[model samples]
Target: MAGGLLRWPVVLCLLNTLIISPVRSTVWTAGSAAMTQGTAVVVGAAAVSSTDEHFVCATLDWWPPEKCDYGTCAWGLASLLNLNLSSHILLNAIKAFSPLKIRLGGSLQDKVIYETEYPQEPCRPFVKNSSEMFGFTEGCLPLSRWDQLNEFFRESGATIIFGLNALNGRVPLSDGSLGGPWDYTNAASLIRYTVNKGYRISGWELGNELSGSGVGARINADQYAEDLMNLDRVVDQTYKGYQFKPLVIGPGGFFDANWFNEFIVKAKSSLDVISHHIYNLGPGVDQNLVEKILNPSYLDGEASTFSNLRDILKSTGASTSAWVGEAGGAYNSGRHLVTNAFVFSFWYLDQLGMSSLYDTKTYCRQSLIGGNYGLLNTTTFKPNPDYYSALLWHRLMGPKVLSTKFNGTKMIRAYAHCARDSKGITLLLLNLDRNSTAQVVVDPGTAQLSAVKYHRGGVKEIKMGEEITREEYHLTAMDGNLHSQTVLLNGKILDLDAQGGIPVLESVKVDALQPINVAALSIVFAHMPSFYAPACV
Candidate 1:
């Protein structure tokens, strides 16, 4: 009897282990529950007009180059000494996104004086001791240097939107405002020089932050309008024989409703693009950088500015399209790890998605290589996390914007586009959820299903019969620190080679029939190479 009892217990234990042990892996299924409670992302075939092709652009600061020490430059000691305009690494990276647009303007731009002759000696770098904002000693961009810059841009397929000095030699008015019948002799000479040399410039932006409620010294709207007219005359006169004339854009300042309305009205039709700058998240020193970026509500707040500007342009009957000419989330050179890190993508990518919806024609990121916010590391000239994010966006997202609906928590934000040069759709899914993982199933909607069968809209119950393949390019931090600059794509770290060459993008194949498992606190770009949406083609 005792031997029989022992054998029975052993047998029961084995059965219990077989029945209760966890499965080797858990494949989270997507169903009505996922649609109802988790996240249901539906992408429609209806197409918005082709978005601005040059939507992703970058800027170059006016600060003269200096020695780099651990990615941080001594702003005070910095002179235009170390900037290799044709650095192999820099040009190679820029060429990756060929036909790139780079704006050569910043705070120090207003202080610059264009010297027709090359300086006998390089300008001595000096720091100004002043309480005023952006108070830096004068720097000169010699004609010889400008030629070198033009050659660099031409070779790299970059178009330049050069900012001319508006505050240089301006007369301070009785009202304590900077009044300008601004001096354009130097500027005009430079324009003539550029046109004479046959350098292809896309635009000539007049001033930086001198528009409405200007930086430190305000410029009246009426005065700025006159200045633009002067610059316009110069451009027209200089490019008379040329086939293409560069665009004239200006008033690149923070959007103040009163200031922007007045400037647009005064500038009239002279402006080619209505430009504005936004650093919505305030200064970089704020301690809540992580929280602010992760919060969707904070990210959504920037939309109001976009809407207001568009409305103003429409109300004024201006033909100019709106451009977020300069935006770098937090000002004051940006936070070290926060701006340069992978977490910044949540903010950067969201801006790209949100701005397109509001009809923003072009968005230029501040400081392509100077400040801490640069897409590339200042010292090493290595592509930062945001660089890869921008590259993936440039490679995958097309000009046509598609409508996407996410019926779930705001944690999962989604944007869709027709894949560039391909007969398919691309979806950018950002899982901002701090804890819960999201399983996303792409519903191609009625248009995609009907086209699959009869090559047109007909059946309501049409299904994708075969397994559809998808390529997912995920951008996530290896260890989970949001501020870490180390980014992993499809489970591999992207590092430069011995020759400073960037690695080719790798993707993991996923079946469209299955749910896409989006890990928490990550960004996934799913490319459907098969679903040929009409808008995409």
Candidate 2:
């Protein structure tokens, strides 16, 4: 049986009451709750690694409303053609970060035809065809629709990484391998059109998970390299008169060391970013999904992927950096009440922390607004728990990642980074143990609870002196339900406002010297304004 804090959590659920104050719009005082004191370490001296400025990214897949998985169709009108681009919430969600990276491509991307003027073809939407690959006929992207998308992107202040079809004009071999040169004809025309229209494309990624042991169709490493070089040429030529050319990202697939090492060595300098996908949590419908998420050993299993990729990048001296192109913990569109609920934040936030620790440049979650794993609700365009998590990460955590260690319990996962826009560092603490509360101490050198207080004690607002205070944003599910869509930040409910805008993510101030109190099954973002780190400075 999973244990919980004292009567406070139950009281909140029973009364259906929330504690909110008016001093700060988003701030709330922490009432008494059960918190077991413990010792955890935050190496505040310097940073162990760093990530890209826009480290937090999300994908916008090409799957239409007809896209389904395991007999369930979760994707509504969230496709590019039908998403409410003018939605105030959608605009506010992306604009909240001022600049969120949105990847525009997916499995259907390889089969998509971009409508161009010169070789104008019939521009149509995706039609359900079970016989065709990816369960859809070749879709067409109308130039007019492209204009609308770009307009929405511009208004939302988003960084765009458009994926191109690499298997174009290639015939499928007997073994399901795409063979032949990438006919960059249509792609080049689209690139040319984008350049002429002055679209600010952050990158032009080739293919979708079609590298080693590809997902639908595999491409030879050497052939893929040649195609990448051709892509580089096309990009350079298309943006000849432009001030800057979009980055050429390629071979976005699961990490296969041998294939990656060879591709990196062969495609040297041609590729700007080496990308990979992560579906470590298994399929969406797995019965043990929750159990796997709560298991520390299972969560740490993905470290090898990051570490190995880092090794490949270093050993080969590859000029390109690593990026998790697309990762939705549960693949096949993800599971409902699991991937879309508050519990998933455990996996999502942990991935952000873990990936950054490995020096990953960018980590893009699977769907920005599609499928069951979407950060935003498919119908109302409201922010999900993961959306708030991502937003908080973007607003608080900086690019510089610090070395954080927790020697106490495996149930407590910790990651620290320099504050995004402040002095000091932001520490993300995820408590997977539902039975015991975790009280974290930033530095081992700081005053810690005695051994006697390990299993019993109430959360405190201890006097750390110097009026030094830290900002803490605690995220928990409503009614203590992990499957709840509504989230409470600092004990205040988070939701879209009357104006359909994301609610303010406020924080409560606690004594800087006090040990951070992390509730069970909850996540905490503690910003220590007093702790000075060389990396942060």
On lDDT, the candidate that comes out on top is: 2
lDDT tens readout by residue for model 1, 316-381: 998888887888898877888988888999999999888877778888997677666888887778
Give per-model CA RMSD.
Answer: 8.9, 7.4
Alpha-carbon RMSD, candidate 1: 8.9
TM-scores of the candidates are: 0.86, 0.90
After aligning candidate 1 to the native by TM-score, how far in Å is the CA of 17 from where it should be?
40
Model 2 scores a TM of: 0.90
